[model samples]
Target: MNGDWLLRGRDGRLTVYLPSGEAVLCRAERGPGGPWEDAPRTVGGTQKLHPGAAVGQGADRYAHLAAWRPTVPGESGLVHTTHFRPLLAPLDWVPIGHPDKKGDRTGPPAVAVDGPGRGYVFVRNAGGGVSLRNQKVKGGWGGWLDLGGQEIEERLAPVAAESGRVELYACAPGAILHWHQEGDGKKPVRAAEVEAAVRPGTLRALATSAEHTTVFFTDDSGDVCAWRPGEKPVPLLAAAGPGPVSAVRCVIEGHDCTVLAQRSASGRVAFAAYPTEQESAGAWWTESGPQLPSDALVAVALDEHEELVAASLSPSTGTLLLTRRKDEPGLALEAWREI
Candidate 1:
């Protein structure tokens, strides 16, 4: 898998993506926190880490794709079974107008869960409106509700999820989408003014348990904004190299959380992360280099503890940098904790 990347689930199932395409069932079981009995779950189909696993409900293994992209998956169309196989009807191409004009976008419609099945997906619509879509999972199909709308923009990644559905943020638009599981009915109601700021910034989504949510973004000048929603957005490492922050990936291996962000300078891509207390990301970015299927894309997933996992990509290039923890520093790769 030599393309942009996304960690789909805690099952450690990696989705190697290509510009306008992707390859599913890329990697296999590794590290920890996954159901030991179901250590090796395959991609495609409604494969759950455990038979008792439910979507954002009960005490069971949490299952989700590391990320989503709207690309055609190598002209195969993301609706193909090799990418994602649902029993639902084949998705008819809506031709949301010119997909190219929209800037940097990722995979198909996907949702990250913090509390329950409060459907949250990325919508690539007309007039370059980069937005978030929410669907309530109550044993029925809930019409996709629009969340955040980017005036004129491109791609995005799965922001964050916790005890309560917080903000779903993305990049190129430098905005955030907000959703809440409302009134005894787990319906993800859309709210206006979800955009956190107007300053250009890097947008990264990390998953975790019912504890925290992480949103990473970068500014036009190259400064990064790490947001936790209700909390103020903080700056991670400064843009030491040339280009803006390319991508950011958050992964949970054992007990620690790690974020891998990519920076493209003089056409060179470098990936790194900012760790946190809890692995609070369901998806992230992967297009750091020119190696991803859809060029720039998003990633997300849940570990066995139902904790969140993720990664991110940059402006283009399409290469991915994964983040797990670094045992040397108590993290997975080289990261320690968010602090």
Candidate 2:
């Protein structure tokens, strides 16, 4: 199978979702850079599954997952878990929403968690509309609500701001469209589009601060561009990588930092970081990581200790490789080690 994986590491464990509808959960007893003492366990392989997305609820020690599936024949829908703990699996997955019988899901659904452990799922319908579902604080899930936009492309990703606002982004014919319910529940969904000069691939969003929420994507020109709130898109790296890019917000050295990882056309996978404490749009990107196979799928995240870890999937051999980087007192860039 042509597999896609979404990985998340937190609270001394890593959760990996395979395209075949299986989730492999691992526990890192010696921490992220150490060996996974427990044997990885797999769950849920009965149905066809799309790639999955995950987000952690800060301080609650819980993570939420959302993945698209055809639970019923000819019906494209979403399966999710609200009280998911990576180290503990065999979850009771719940069906939240589905497309109309005449319509189908156009792409993978994205998931994000707010400060209160509330989860949000965003998916694009075949009719070119974006559908969203929210997990209520008390219990159960809310109904599928239309965010309302025309010509919204198939692929979309959701990012939850620290301020409890969730933003959804999609690429259109000539620009990228973003929709969000900014304030209270009564407000209508706000929509905006940035006229980017390049086509986007694998879009990722991060709410860096109250002042700046950024979206990063791989452009058609094999470069990484950042789109800040209310501003035009700018190039973060000029032709730095090929293939795909992944970005996440994490705490690094007591400051909130944006970590970007990419695989180049030459089969080399590397990462860069931009700290929020710095004020330059022309920020420097530090590269550190072992090279991965050209065909490998890559993912990056911070462990419980806030250290950086990168993982790659070699589909041909079914091998998953992980690399970890440690920051020292005076080191500019630390070396990456395979775990």
Candidate 1 has an lDDT of: 0.38
Candidate 2, 208-299: lDDT as tens digits: 77865677776777567778758777777754565546666676667677777776655666666676524354544445555566667777
Each model's lDDT: 0.38, 0.60
Best by TM-score: 2
Best by lDDT: 2
Tens digit of per-residue lDDT, candidate 1, span 254-288 = 43445444434433334454346322333233223
Give the Cα error of residue 264 in candidate 1, in Å: 4.3
> Runs in model 2 with CA error above 4 Å?
1-10, 21-33, 44-61, 101-103, 184-188, 250-256, 277-291, 329-339
lDDT score, candidate 1, position 273: 45
Q: How many steric clashes between backbone atoms does each model show?
A: 80, 0
All candidates' TM-scores?
A: 0.51, 0.82
